[model samples]
Target: MRRAIAAAMSRSKREIPHYYLEHSIDISKAQDWLQAHNAERTPEQRLLLGALLVRAAALTLKQTPELNGYYTDGRFDPSSSVHIGMAINIRGGGLVVPALLDADQASLEQLMERLKDLTGRARHGGLRSSEMSAATVTLTSLGDRGVDSVLGVIFPPQVAILGFGTPVLRPWITDTGSVEARPVLRVTLAADHRVSDGHLGARFLRELTRKLQSPESL
Candidate 1:
């Protein structure tokens, strides 16, 4: 632990102590909306995206509260905050995730603002130690590296990790019955065998996709 922290230098090494959960999401419309969302992105998108993911994870995790918190000394500790650890790729090939502050309860807008601020700080090497240690769940977005879908290892103590894939252009049949290009993302989910079954994992993926397809893109 000390070595890892030293490697971080001023940076904080998140010490998570529980098993993990992993989720991969495929969004067919992600590419299209990301382009538009980028054009009009306000730090607001940060909260909106975080809220969407929190809500998505909550929907599934709430189904089994036993998996919602830390599992230490061979036991689970339930958590009230749906704090989400968001993974970010900054310079130097170091992947860091600053927990979205109180994400489970934050309003959409609030989540976005905090996400933007935390991410900015992380990039500049300004993240505080507390910020790194607070996450209850980790969400990873690989920028453009996620092409389709990726199954990620669950970060420890969180019980889950969500990965995002790069959007790809695929052929889709339009309403006019003509083949057209469509943006689609592949999704994957990994769950702790002790806490999640294939059925639960599938259900989570279904809900995530529904959110992405909702009026507000997840």
Candidate 2:
């Protein structure tokens, strides 16, 4: 697994003209909404912040097709469906990224359930072939590792990858001009320069932020 990863990442860096962008998103509203929403539910019925991030990215990708597709044979082909590759680490060895097929269509609760199942399967084996190869884009996070941010390499064929960092309490200025400590998530996007530019990437991040801020809409 390590050998395979090294080869892919080496190819990604050598062939893909990578461009990166980072955004500091204030997720106070979303966090608060999630807290309130999960308060009445049983522990097993509650949701996770990662699911919300994935759902937002999947929906945002629908509007930003250039960032969600394959760049092969010197050409780019955009996918109509959004298959989000979730990066899951194995217990003692490597990692596996399995796609949550048609991620944009799933609800928050559905995404949470699917993510749990996928993560378990990825660690224990039994991942489907389609899940292994059908991803249009990938999402990875180091939040559990307590990292401030991460800059990921673009996986081959796919044009982009998104990374999320740990949610930390940062000083933020509110709409009313008061300062408060809010949970801020740092998001990074690594895209193939052959298919898109920094401007488009910035727009994609903005849309993702909008989707995240309006948790009820997602």
Candidate 3:
């Protein structure tokens, strides 16, 4: 497993011209919405913040299609569907990203259920080949470990990886010019320079933030 990871990283570093863009997303509204929404559900059926982030990214990719595809054979191949790789760590060791096929078409409730199932199966080594291979883009997060930010390497064949950090309380100004502490999530995008640029990356992040702010639509 280590050798395979090392080889993939080596190829990623050698072949992909990587560029990174980071954004601080205000997730206060999303958090409030999640809490209220979860309060009405059973504990096992509740939504996770990570799942919400994945949904947001998936929806954003629908509009910014360039960031949701592969770079191979000296060309960029755009996928018609959005298959997001949700990175999950194994119980004892290692990690895997099982693809959530057509995530953009799923409702928030459906997405949460699928994400829970995928992570559970991933830790138990129950993922199928299609789940492992169909990822058009990847989403990674270190929120549980409290990492501030992550600058991920672009996984080969795929052109981009979106990373999320721990959501922290930060001072924010409201529309009425009032200051308050809000939950801010730091998001980073690492993409193949051959397929995208900083402008597109920033736009994707902005769209993602907009989606998160309106959790009801997710």
Candidate 4:
């Protein structure tokens, strides 16, 4: 059904219109924390950890303010809330995104509890139309799928989409200019050209990298 829809949409210029934006996030530091902390949780908790990372990004966006809202009315409205759409399985196949809004303001406990419900509804096809509609931004994971990184298309009207890939052990530079094995995940940020500039995009990645190092946010 999704393939059919995508094909049909592609036949026209404006149907499901999109633009591609690509950027990479080196998550070597964040994975080190996840590997250790993952041992403390059940499988469910580990899954929720992915959602937490997305929520953390929304928090990072909240700080920037400019990157936090949907572009509408030929103008950008700085969202007072941070709503991040989480992509999960669609009915039978493909995927759907159910949002976890205002994550920046939500307490840790609230995020966990709400995410459980959102992810559940998303997989089972019970997600409300409204939940899938009002996404200010997106955070999608392809961990189990084995993608390294994806330069995805911006879901129309939304300014950006974030894609995450599996973490694998690889060699990276140290302060000593030596090599060390680090677990790294690739992140691709796709943005609408009308909304984001090269400098703001660079700033977003810099801030996100700093958040990964904060430890507590993880």
Candidate 5:
């Protein structure tokens, strides 16, 4: 596993030209929706914010398709399906990303349930080979660890990786010029510069923010 990871990182560093974009999104609506949704569920069955972020990314990719594919053989190949590779940290140490198949088609509740199942299976070394290799794009979050932001490395063959930082309460100016404290989340995307430009990256972030703010759609 160590050799495989090292080889993959070495290939990514040597081959991919990575460009990063960062944005802070107001997730107040998403938070409110989550809190209310969880009120009727058991503690073990409640949703995690990371799952919502994944759902949002999946939805964003439907519009910004350039960021959701692989780069290989000196060209970019866009994927027709959106299988999100969710990064999960093992209990003892190390990390693994298991693909959540057809994330864009799942309902919010179904996505949360699938995420819980994936994380549990990944930590216990129960992931299938197809799950390990079928990811069209990846999502990593260090928010639970209290990191403010991250500039992630692009995992190769895959053209991009989306990262989420810890959510914090910050003063936000409303359209009416009133300042209010809102829960803001920092999101970053690292993409292959050969396949996409900063303009597309910005558009992707905007769509992601829009999806996150309208959590009802996820």
Candidate 6:
């Protein structure tokens, strides 16, 4: 596992020119909706905010094709389907990232269930071969670990990786000129510069923020 990780990281740094973009998104609406949504469901069926983030990112990728695909053999191959690689840490050490297939097409409930199942399988060793190799893009989060923010390394072949930081309560100015404490999440995008520029990355983050602000659609 260590050897595999080292090889992938070395190749990523050696071959992919990476550019990063960060956005502090106000997820107050999303959180509120999640809380309300969870209130109506049983404990075993409740959804986490991570599910929403993945869903939003998957949908946003449809608009930004440059960030979601493989770069191999000196070319970029875009994918019509969105398979988000979810980073899951093992019990003792290391990690595995398994792709959640067709994430853009899955409902929030289904995505949550699949994410939970994937995490369990990844940690305990039941992940399939397809899930291991089918990711178009990867998503990692340190929110549970109390990290304020993270800038991730671009996984080779895949053009981009997204990092989500812990949601913090901050004073935000509203459209009506009122100061309110809102749950703000810092989202970072690390993309292969060979395939995309900063402008496209910025647009992708903005689109994600817009989707997160209105979580009902996810």
Model 5 / residue 44 / CA error / Å: 4.0
Tens digit per residue, CA lDDT, model 1, 1-218: 44653554332123332232344343445434545655766653423343455555554555555445664565667677666777787876667878775665665566656767887898898998878888776676654564556556566565666666665677867768998877665555555555556676666767667776662633
Please list all clashing residue pairs in model 4, or write none if there are none: none
Q: After superposition, how far is residue 1 of candidate 3 from its true place, in Å?
A: 0.5
lDDT of 4 at 158: 65
- Using alpha carbons, what is the TM-score of model 4? 0.82
> What would the per-residue lDDT of candidate 3 be over residues 88-159, giving only the tens digit for each residue?
888867778789999989987799889888988898778999999999999999999999899998889999
lDDT of 6 by residue, 26-102 (tens): 99999999999999789999999999999999999978889889999999999999999988899888879999999
Q: Which candidate should be chosen as best, given TM-score against the real structure?
A: 2
Please state the error at residue 21 of candidate 3 in Å.
0.5
Tens digit of lDDT per residue, candidate 4, span 79-197?
78777888786657877777787778776557777888898877766778778776777787888788777665555556677777777777878779999877676776766556667
State the TM-score for model 6.
0.98
Model 2, 64-108: lDDT tens digits are: 999988998989999999999988999888878899999999999
lDDT of 1: 0.60
Predicted structure 3: clash tally: 0
Ten-residue region with minimum lDDT total, candidate 2? 87-96
Q: Report, for every candidate in turn, its global Cα lDDT versus the true structure.
A: 0.60, 0.95, 0.90, 0.69, 0.89, 0.93
RMSD of 5: 1.3
Name the better of 4 and 5 by lDDT: 5
What is every candidate's alpha-carbon RMSD to the true fold? 5.7, 0.7, 1.0, 3.3, 1.3, 0.9
For model 6, the stretches where C-alpha displacement exceeds 4 angstroms are: none
lDDT of 4: 0.69
lDDT of 4 at 182: 71
Model 5: CA > 4 A from native: none
